[model samples]
Structure formats: structure tokens, C-alpha cells
Target chain A: MRRADRLDRLQSALDAGGYLRLKDAARLLGVSEMTVRRDIASCDGRFAYLGGYIAGGLESAGGMGYILDRERDAHIEMKRTACDSAATLLKPGETVFIDCGTTTTHLASRIPADSQITVVCYAMNIAEIVCKKPGLRVVMLGGLYHASSASFSSPESLEMLRGIGINTAFISAGGVHESLGISCSNFHEVEIKQTAIANAVTKALVVDSSKFDQVKPAFFAKLNSFDFLCCDDGIDPARAERLAAAGVRIMLP
Target chain B: MRRADRLDRLQSALDAGGYLRLKDAARLLGVSEMTVRRDIASCDGRFAYLGGYIAGGLESAGGMGYILDRERDAHIEMKRTACDSAATLLKPGETVFIDCGTTTTHLASRIPADSQITVVCYAMNIAEIVCKKPGLRVVMLGGLYHASSASFSSPESLEMLRGIGINTAFISAGGVHESLGISCSNFHEVEIKQTAIANAVTKALVVDSSKFDQVKPAFFAKLNSFDFLCCDDGIDPARAERLAAAGVRIMLP
Candidate 1:
């Protein structure tokens, strides 16, 4: 295959799969593992090899906020399914904190248009879409702007979040594990997520099944920090049982 | 042309022209004025007859915030040139206010990438772009979200704006005239603008030639309210002199 075609195929796979295992990617692309390795670097620093797979912008794992666009499109049905379950928690006149994530955007969108509520979020995408929901007030946290996440998350954003009362805080995590706890890839997000959890009356972690049984660099909250977990049905029954026994309710959809 | 095609054409004209004078639009669309009138209603409430032209969502003129999208695209080179001149006024380490307008967005974009300054804006578009500039602090005013303008502007937004001290205020006006002064179409914007002018150390009005020689419904400030006016070169020499003579330095770009 041509070099350009191989690189294009690699991006498609990475975007859809979020992570590309070298051997699997080679087979999928009908190229040798060596070719995959050589061509993968062409993605610049967007993908980084970790253990067995190449992850999307592993460098971004440091601190820059950007929507994991490809991973977002990957498990649409699962994200929506989890979001649908999350939507049931929303009540009229309640204030909510929506963390920036694909699953969370779906959760915000699932709110019925007629319901009256106040949403405080730092993400531009969440703020923009949530504003259209009828009878709702949107307060976009002001601070340092991160275009990738389309939200504000900094010391100032955290300061603004501190002043408000959140009835429910739906947190997004890079990894959710029974023992390792809830974690994220970026270091900068740790403080804000911690603040949101600490300030809210009720805390819940929203993630797809894919994030289960994994660990990320920056640990924000423990599994016990959330009152419950809302996820897709793909999660292992045993793991779900362990979390449920520990105290957090496992909500599957 | 098909009905959809004609409607699309009408929208393009309205978007480009802000308000499309029926006779001129009919000539451009190669249709009779009667046909133009008949088809315009099909746009639902997106466009309406205002005096002799079809205006964008005449209902919104009451107060809702929106960008005159197509009209901003209408005078790109002129807007950029005006923005370039405005950029010269930005000083490193000083905080500034950029009102929600394409002209102002251009002004934000034209700021030197390496300049160390703080920007407080209500528009998402401006925030998204300005955040990318190096050594800059971007503070998006939090309040009611308006998708049309991609910014926050409300009672809460005004309160937030009042708390900050801006070294320079780059105001976007709907119309600028010698006698009528600075005015805007929406009533909700007047007080916030008035507050900005009052709180700002230095204020300058930014608009293109199209906005000159007219008066909008809601007047916010007088000719002497601004220290200067940044406008396109197309503004007539006589009017420029009148504004200049009235304590507002006229910058033609």
C-alpha cells in the first residue's frame, strides 16, 4: 500500500479505536508491523506507544484540554446509553455541574427541553448546547480558555466553581477502577475535578465501559468519592459487584 | 430555480447585507420583487421586512443577541485592515475588553501572538481564538449564553464586567453617526455597554463604513463617549472629519 494510504488508515483506526495495538493495526491495515511502526511516527506526536498500544496524543496526557474527538465518535451508542441513564437523575430547579466529556455532553443533551434548571460548566461546547434547553440558565465558568475542551479550567475557573452550589456533579474520568480510583490524563484538571466533587451535594462519575479497570496519571478522586457510577452494560459483572459492595451504586444501561 | 434554492439565495443576501432592500435583492436574485416578498416569509422568523429590506429575525432586534454572520463576511478585507489598525493600540501587560463582533474578533486575532496582555470578552469565538495567543490571559464573561454571538451577556455578565478594570475598551457599535452618536439595535446591550464605558479607562468605537451614517433604536453613548473611532477607509472624508472634530480621532484603514 502507499505510504499516505497507510497513514490515513492508521488515523481512521486510532480515531475509532482510541488506541491502536501495533500487531492488530498491522493486520487491519494489511501492512507489516514494521511498516506500521515506521508510518505511525508520521502522525507526529499525536499518538504515543504505551505498553501494547499507541494512544492518541499521549503527550496531551500532560495538561492541554482537547476533546478526544476520535474516541468520542468511537462508542456513540454506549456513551448515549450511559447518558440516558444519567439523565434520569436530573430534576427541575436543580443546579448541576457537567464535566467536559463525550459521555457528559450526551448527558446534558438528554435533559428534556421543558425542564427548568441551572447548569454551571466550564466547557464551551457544554455551555453552548445546554443554553438551548428551554427554561435553563447557563453559567460558563470564566478563566483561562482551553479551545480543545471548549471550556475554561484553571485557577480562576476553579475559583468561580467554588462560589456556586452544585446539586449534582457529574464527573468525567479517563479511567475508573475499583482499587486504583477515578483518574484523568491531564495534571491541570486534577484540582478542578477535586473542587467540583468537594463542592457538590451529590457526586457521580460518568464513563463508558471502555474506561473501566484502567489507570491514568493524575488521580483526582477515589472510587468512593462518587455516590454512584453510570456506565454501559459492557462492564464485567464481577467488577460491578465489587464496586457496588464497596458503596457506590452501579447504574448500567 | 427550485423553491429551496431561492430561499437559500435570500438567506445569503440577508446574511451578507444584514437587511436586503427588496428591489435590490430582486435584481440580484433575478426574480420579481413580488416573488421575493412571497418567498421571504417561508424563512419562518429568521428574516423579516424592516422598512424597505428583509432583516434577520426582526423579533430578535428587540433584545436577543446574534451575530450578523453573513454581513461580517461581506467586508473581510476592510474589517481586517481596521483590525490591524486597532491592533497597534494594544499594549503589552494591559487588560482590554473586546465586545462581541466580527470586527472585534478580528481585532483580537490581530493582536501580537507574543504580547503579554489580558483580554476579557463575552464571545465564545473571541475567547476560543484569543486563548491561542501566547502570554495572554483570557477571561470569558459568564452569564446567559447566546449561541448567535457565541458569548455571555446578561445581568450577571454585566456584574462580572463591572468588577474588572479594563485599560482599554474596544466597543462594537451597530451604528455610529456624528449627531446620533453610538447606538445598537438591542436594548439589553445598552446598560452593559454603558457600564463598560464608565468602567473603562479608555474607550474606542470600532465599526465598518456600512454602520456609518445611521442610528439604531437603542442609543448607548454619544460621539464624545469614545476617544477614537477605528473604521474602514470607505467611510466618507466629510463624516470622518466631523467625528474627528468631535474629540474622536478617526482611524481609516
Candidate 2:
């Protein structure tokens, strides 16, 4: 088949499935994965190639939001331990803000089913889990649903966060550099996270040890902004000392 | 155990599980289901027993919202048929509003994965399913999470709906009375439904045949407010004709 024919077939498959994996596109077009990649590259701005999946131009142009599933199992046990330690800080009757991320999902689950606390969240994954508990009241921030993160965000959601009195804010980050500050993948999340930090009595940064020293695209807060850090025992002693010296307490599980 | 002790154990279980079935509560207290029901009844304002499940006082006092799971299987095939018919009205590139309810979930699923349309929804269940499709841009109106309905609603969600341009509003209701108007179980859903109806170009009411003649607590719209009724073959012909004569077209699968 001609290269044009192959590209047409790939486009048809993407139109049908909404998205196609690179390998799937190759098989559907009867070409090698490398050929499929080259074909997609040839069509500038025609498709979004993110995390091995190809999506239509409309979605690509809108934004290729963060894909949470790929990062879900990256550091599973450590995330759970970190979140478990973080969950302990939540007291009954207080309102807490749970940030949007896979690590915070573990914290959402560790929350006592009958804690009688109100949970303020912006992510679907976190809200769905806690909403079922009859003892917990859930305040969900609404906005445009980003398929990339399975989370909601808008100016209205940020405004909603400001009005709520949060006792503690359990925040998640993609990177936690001492000097460069804390960051996450989506730019939409910055204002909401910053608002939570400003309004909450205690701002707790909950992340696995692997996030240390890494800097993601959207920076939200500085390291000193958090009251403390909840993480697993995988942190290097020197690194822990550095954070501690920087006036950020590291709470390990 | 004394009656007070049994009540204490029941409260503890309800706290741990958020909610418990009557049978499980009885087993945990080592008593008959009837005895457990009596105990819950004796507690009066302390416990909420709804649809065979026992929940804590906080949830019980905060309005026993409509439970979607219990109604999920009732007339399910007919609901699916009705929603399937409703889903056909959707066109690519048009923005639509999907109302919250178990029946609407079918419509959410049947939406073409590659139809480049924007879906505005207030329910977590509806948002979670449609957000994964790459061709769909989802605008989720967020607010307090209602566990009974697996939906979100707030004053701001209504405000958010007012600003968006909705081409079609696919509404679901608990009751569809001819003279009494359309109604739902929760009062919070009323304003959102009314706002969507007032703003949209086409208002379609999607309900199973059983909903006809039923009168729920919250009334949101009159029968003539809808442009069409998408329902199953089970709808009584006489009733369909009456609705048609009243200026509402009935679209069936």
C-alpha cells in the first residue's frame, strides 16, 4: 500500500476508536510500529501521540492531559504507606482537602469509613471512593472534566475551595525540588492547590519518596509552604536532612 | 447483650462500614433482623434505616437522597431501550447536557466514542464513563457528592449550567405526571434540571414507562416543557397519544 493509504487507514481506526495505541495502529495499517510513528510524524499537528496512544487532532489541540493509569502502579507500596501515614492526621468533624493524584487516592481509601469528616476534592477517583461512606460528607469541586487526569477544574472550583474552611490539605505533587518548588503535570491544578494551601490550617504534602528532586511542568508551591511531608522510608538520609534543614518536616512510615 | 449494647455494636459497624444491610447488622449483633430493625427504630433520630440499609445519624438527617442502586435493576431493559433511542438524537459537534440518573448512564455509554461532541454533566457516574473517550470534551459541574445517586449538585452547578450553551438537554426524572409536571427525588436536582431546560435548544425527557403517573417529591418542569419523550416500547399507546396530543412527541426504540 502507498504511504497515503496507510495513513488513511490509521486515521480511520483512530476515528473509530477515539484513540489507538501505536502498536495497534501499526497492526491495523499493516505496517511496522516505526512506520506508523513516521506516518504520524509526517502529519504535523494532525494527531496527538502521548504515552504510546494516538488521538485525534481536536483532543491533541485541546491538550493532552496527564494520564494517571500509567503512573498508578509505579511505586505502589510506597504510595500506600505514605498515604496511610497521612490519613492518620485527619480528625473527625474537620474538613480536609484531598488533591488530585494517584498517591492521594490511597489516602482517600485509608480514611476511616465513619470518620464523620467532610472531604473536599476535585478529582473523580478521590470523590467516588469517599462519597460512599455514610459517615463522610463530600464537597466536590466542579469544572471541565479532563480525560487525561479524570479530574475536574475551573475558576469556579477554585472559588469554591476558597470558601471552605479546610483543617488539613493533603496535597500531591509530581516533583518536590527544594529550591525549584513543588509541581504537578497539569497547569489547571495550580490555582486550586495554591488556594487549598492558603486556606487550610495545615498543608501536608503527600508523595512517594521517588518524587523528591524532580520538577514537573506546573509549579504550585514552595517546599516551605507545607507543614510537613508524608512519605515512605525510601528517602536517602542526606536528602531527608536537606529537607529538614530547609524547615520542612519529613514524616516517614 | 443488652438492647443498648446491641445498638452500640450496630453503631460501631455502621461507623466502620458507612452503611450496613439489615441482615448484616442483625448478624453482627447476633439477633434477628426484625429485632435489629426494632432496635434501629427505637433509636429514632439516631439511625437511618432506608431500603434495608442502616446508616449513621449524620447521613440520615441530611435527607435520604434517592438510591440509584436499588432502582437500577427495575425495568432495566426498558430503560436501556429508551436511552438507546434517546442516544440516536445526538449529533457530532453539538454540545449536550446529560442529566443524572441510572437510566442516563445507558445514554452516556451508547454515545459514539468518536463523535466529537461536548458533554456537560453533573453526575460522577456519568462523567467518569464519558471522560475516557478521546473524542468527547466533558464539562463536569461539580458540587457536594450525593452517594445515594452517585451524582453531584450545588448552587454553583446550576450557575455553571446557565453559562454553557447546550444544544440538547437529555433529562431523566423519577416521576412524569401529565398535569402535575416532571419531578425527581432530590430537591438539589430541581434547579439544575430547570436551568438546563431553560437554556437548551431541544429538551428531551428520557424515562422508563414505569415513571409515568408517579409523583416524586421535587417538581422541576411541566410535561409540555419537553420537546420529545424518548421511551421504550412498553409505554402505553393511550398514554403516548395523550402526551403527543399535549404537544410532546414520543420517540421510541
Candidate 3:
């Protein structure tokens, strides 16, 4: 497992459970207590060290940009392959909305250097990468900063998003299930994702195969909400057929 | 010098002179040609190395977010000391605007991890630093991304700035003169700086003594625009006194 993904999983566990015991976080993340300790340390002041438990400050302030930087390396190949598949759908000069997610980050990385596209983003990491491409205009939504997401979200951010016309949007979520549809762990993020989907002409849910059939709380979109679903081949065959039968276009690796 | 600051300085030199010979950049930055070679190499497609001179993509883009990253280390001690003096003016819980500049990045770094303050910024580098501190809310004004500045700016960005009421603003500039006042090379940046000064209750001009008495093209504010001037004591006594007499408070380190 990649360390960034582990750290993100650890943060999710902490946010869900309020506090995570070092042993449990390590066991769930398939790592040692030492790695979990290091993850917490790398988080700097975002996590409070309470003896055996790590307390993540997800709700202590507004819109903690919850992008776990280290998580980018976790499941690296799967993310890259999935992102590459997603890129096949993009055309030059199209205006795209990229949300803050470890997997979606790969799409930004995969974007052609010389592609003249307008990227609408909500985070620093993506902006840093996308802005370097010459002749591209990056519109970053501004508002309350969420340290964990590493993106901005608030009334203002949503208002800003409403002003842009998106041709295609690659949205991300923590999990998807037949019943729950699509969801992420953080409830604060759901509305922004929904808003992006609402404003986009064509919307695709870009998640890895591991997220298939799983369900997270704070549902954002229904299964039919998206025009396409982009994921790696790790998806179960049976579930893929079921989703495709339900009218969701699947972008396969 | 840090790699980011070095790249920024190289780009600034490239922007000013249009072309920079390899030997000149190495000699000017007081680094080895090998290090300069690596910077051009690491610009990661931003620069085209044509024989002996480095080519930057300046005119081919918009707003260029040119707050020099590596140049933060150019006058390392002096910039830090000037920023340290500026830090003394900050109070807990106040909303402060930190503009994109090498010297102001020092202020972001120097901010105590435990200090509870709201940071309003337009760039990712400072947002990444400021959002790490727990209990602080970061409001990043988002708009069109400028690759060189590594920040966002637009007419809409200025509109957004007009809405926010700032307690203090630590503004940066390329030059400061008794006559031309505070200015920067980019004409695109002047309006935003002017808006920040107008919205700020109290403002401080933060720059190294190197900028003293020099003048850049796009003047943003006058000597009396700021409540305090934060710089190294390397400033000329006569000039400082003349400015002090003109009602500009000086914060020296």
C-alpha cells in the first residue's frame, strides 16, 4: 500500500471514529505503528498526538483542505492507468473541473503539457501542476481552506463554481454502492461535488476499482447522476455489468 | 539557495532580459554552472534550453504567478530579518493578507505554529504553509493561475478582494523609491496590491533593504500608503529618516 493512501485511510478512520488508536490504524492500513506515527508526524499540527491515540482535527475549523499529499503514491499504477483512461475522453481546449482527490491528481499529472485546456480546481497541488503548462488558464475556486482536503470549500466557493461553464468534470468519491450510489467520508465535501456535477455538461465519476461496491457516508450523487464512470480493471465483472446495464458509461483501462 | 527560489530568480532574469546565457545566470546567482543546468532541467518543460541561453515561456501565458520561489534564498538573512520584524506586528485572531513574494513567504514560515490567525492569500505556496497550523482558517482568493507568480489573480480576484475586510496586509514589491513609491515589474499585479491596501485597516510594506531607493515600472502604493515599513536595518539612515518624517512607520530588524 502506498504511504499517502495509508495516511489518507488513517485520517478517514480518525475522522469517522473521532480518534484512532495507533495499533488499529496500523492494522487497518497494513502498516506498523511506526509508520502511523510517522504519518501523524508528517501531518504536522493537523493531528494531535494523544499517547496511544491520534486525533485528527477535521472539524476544529472550516474546510480543512483534506488532500493527503503522501496518499498520491499509494496504488500508484492503478491511479495512473485509470487516469490515463479518463484522459482519452478529454479534448483540447475543453474546460474541465478537477476535484481534490489522490486519484484525480493523476489525471492532472497525465494531462498533456501543451494541451490548451482551462482547469477549474480547488486545491494547491493540482494548481501547481496544471498552471505550469503554457497557454492554459487555471481557475481555482477560493473560499475556506480545508487542510485535509487541501482544497477550498464554502458558500463562496460554491458561488464561484456556479459562475463557470464546465464542459467535462472528473469528480471523485470515497466509495460507491448500488444502494448508497456515491459518497465520500466528509459531508462538507458532498455539496461541492454535487454542485460541480450539476454545472457540468458531462460528468464522470473517476475512482479506482477498489471503491466499487463499497459505501461511504455522506452521499453526494446517485448512480445515474454521472454520464460515465472511469476506473481501473480491478473492478468485479458482475458489478461492472450491473452498472453498465443501469446506463452508466464505464471507461475501462 | 533553495531550488524553488533559484528557479524563480532564473525565470525573473529570463523575463527581464528575454534570454539569459548559462554562464551569466550561474555567475549572477553565485552558483555553479552545473547547478544552473539542473535548474533549467528541473523547470520540467517550463524552460527551453537552447544551447547556452535559457528560454522562458513568459509571453505565451497569462499572469505568470512570478513570486520568485528560489530567490527567497537570494538575500537569505536579510529577507528573514525583515520578515521577522513584520511578524512582530501580527496579533492572534486577526485576518491578514499575505501576498505572493519570497519575503512574505518568510512571514508565512515564521508564523508560530500555535498562533490562531486567519490568513488570506492568493497563492498555493503560502497556503500550503499557513493551513498546516491548527486552529487557523485560510482564505485563498482563487482566480486565474499565474505560473511564474505561483498565485491566482484576475479582475474577479480584485472583485473578491473588495469584499473581504482585512485587518492587516503585508505587501511586497520589487522596488521602493521616495518618488515612484512601492512598485513591481508586472503591471498585472499593481491593481490587486492597490486593492489590498485599500481594504486593509493597517498595511505594512515588507521588502529587503535591497529594494530601497530603487524603482520599478508599475507603481502600486506611495510611501505614505502603508502604516509601517518592514525591512532590514541595512536601509540608509537618511532615506529611512526621510520616509519616517513623511509619516511612514518603520519596522527595522
Note the chain A TM-score of all models in turn: 0.71, 0.73, 0.71
Tens-digit lDDT track of model 2 for B1-253: 4997677555533332135668877876688999988888887966655566665522311122234324533665677779868988999999999998777877876677699999999876676557657789889888887765667887777778889999999999999999999999888888899999999999999999899899999999999999989999988889989999999989997
Per residue, candidate 1 scores C-alpha lDDT tens digits across A93-211 of: 89888887555767776665567788887765465456645467777876556544445654545667777899999888888877777888766677888888999998888888888
Task: State model 2's lDDT.
Answer: 0.76
TM-score of chain B taken alone, every candidate: 0.70, 0.73, 0.72
Q: Write the per-residue lDDT of candidate 3 for residues B70-179, one digit (tens) a residue.
A: 34335745777788789898898888899876567668766666678888888755665576676777888887776666677766667778888999999998898888
Candidate 3 stretches with Cα past 4 Å from truth are: A1-74, B1-73
* Model 2 chain B: lowest-lDDT 10 consecutive positions: B57-66
Q: In CAPRI terms, where does candidate 1 land?
A: incorrect
Provide the lowest-lDDT 10-residue window in model 1 chain B.
Answer: B57-66
lDDT of 1 at B202: 88
TM-score to native of every candidate shown: 0.64, 0.74, 0.73
Model 1: lDDT equals: 0.68
**Tens-digit lDDT string for candidate 2 (A123-239):** 766765576567888999988876555678887778777889999999999999988999999898998999999999998999999998899999999999988899989989998
Q: How far is B139's C-alpha from truth in model 2 (Å)?
A: 1.0
- The top-ranked prediction according to TM-score is 2
